[model samples]
Target: MRIYLPTTLALLAEQHAAGAVLVPDGAVVAEDDSEDAEYAALMTAADASAVQLAGAGRRVVVVADLAAEPAVGAAVPWREVVAVHADVEDRPAGADPDEDLAWFATQEVPDLF
Candidate 1:
């Protein structure tokens, strides 16, 4: 199952160093394999990321695939991360949170920070 983990850049850096990001329960999960479903999931995750942002920063979503549905408080290993979706530029304060995110490959994750 694919999971979208809402997170912040600071946290992302920590995760990068730690090699895994601990995920909370009830994270975004697509209902089906359809593109629309996955998109909805990503949007939902972006919203959740906004809430967590609480201040100036771009939205971020960690895309990872797990063996099965994740349990409560699961940890996503860095190796499991396939891609990252984040704002190409930091959104201005009070800017539209609906701004789209850019896709970055896992190898490019280090350059994101």
Candidate 2:
């Protein structure tokens, strides 16, 4: 399953370097069929990161692919992040409701911090 993580640019870099993104707490934020579902989840994560803006200026949506075995539920506890979609290159600065996320591709994220 493909999951979208709302995080900072620096944290993304750290995850990239570490080869894993760790989810210490909170619910698993991911994309659903509804475009609204995907957007809402992403926005919720971005909103949560507003307090920690010093490390990275813009909110980043990390697209990761996890194995289909583990289902997301109250009983499931996810920790390490493994595979990431290698298509999305960059995340734009600031929030824009007009910006379309469907076009995001796999590539190196630009220095937005």
Candidate 3:
């Protein structure tokens, strides 16, 4: 299953680290374009195209700003869309650090001599 992460640099990095593809949103597309016409056209088409691309059974993770929620809501099917709040931290603090240490311990024997 492929996950499509929207254009938030931090989230994109995090998702990519977690092995997901970074999908650019309308705003990102618009910002990338130099010509006004091209920007407008892409902005208009982005949501629809994104939704179409994220058809049934595909896992789409949309990391859009709060303002973009309404636009995303209209285009993407709710069931397939996982909307992550932009303000929310990518990885919340207090994640299980002990689990990581335990896993590392198994990889190499401790020097108990």
Candidate 4:
């Protein structure tokens, strides 16, 4: 199953360099549909990363296809879901419920590493 893994840019770079996505804890997945729920899970992951690493650098949501299932400890969405690495810039300025998932410049991504 695919999962949305929220992480900092630095960590992402490290993982990229290492050539793997270890499927860390707190990664989220859609308990229902594949399209919308994945989007919602992605947003949730992005929002969570933002909160955890505010001002550290650009946040990243690593969409990965995991072989095994991790513990699911959150509420239900059952919303449609998909796989995509959403940046802070993907979110519009002053958007709805998840404003924290707003976008940031990709240029700064290098510096974060």
Judge candidate 1 against the unseen true structure and give its global Cα lDDT, from 0 to 1.
0.84
Put down candidate 2 lDDT per residue, 1-113, tens digits, no spaces: 54555555676676655555544233245656576886676555555444345332544555455565333321222233432222133433454434433323334343333
Over 2-107, each residue of candidate 3 has an lDDT whose tens digit, in order, gives 1223333343335434543334443332333346653343334333333434432111124222223233223333233333312222223333212111111211
User: On TM-score, who's better, 3 or 4?
Assistant: 4
Q: Cα lDDT for residue 22, model 4?
A: 51
The collision pairs in model 2 are: 86-106, 87-105, 87-106, 87-107, 88-105, 88-106, 88-107
Please report how far candidate 3 places residue 79 from its true position, in Å: 23
* Candidate number achieving the greatest lDDT relative to the actual structure: 1
User: How well does each candidate superpose onto the true structure, as a TM-score?
Assistant: 0.91, 0.52, 0.20, 0.61
Top TM-score model: 1
TM-score ranking, high to low: 1, 4, 2, 3
How would you encode candidate 4's per-residue C-alpha lDDT over 1-113 as one tens digit per residue?
76777877667677555555555566777676577887788788877766656554455776655556655443212221223354544333333535434333433334445
- Looking at model 2, report the run of 10 residues with the lowest lDDT sum: 69-78
By lDDT, rank the candidates, best first: 1, 4, 2, 3
Pick the winner on lDDT between candidates 3 and 4.
4
lDDT of 3: 0.31
lDDT of 1 by residue, 4-77 (tens): 88888888999889999778543798888889998888889888887788877888899998877677677788
Better of 2 and 3 by TM-score: 2
Superposition error at 59 for model 3 (Å): 22
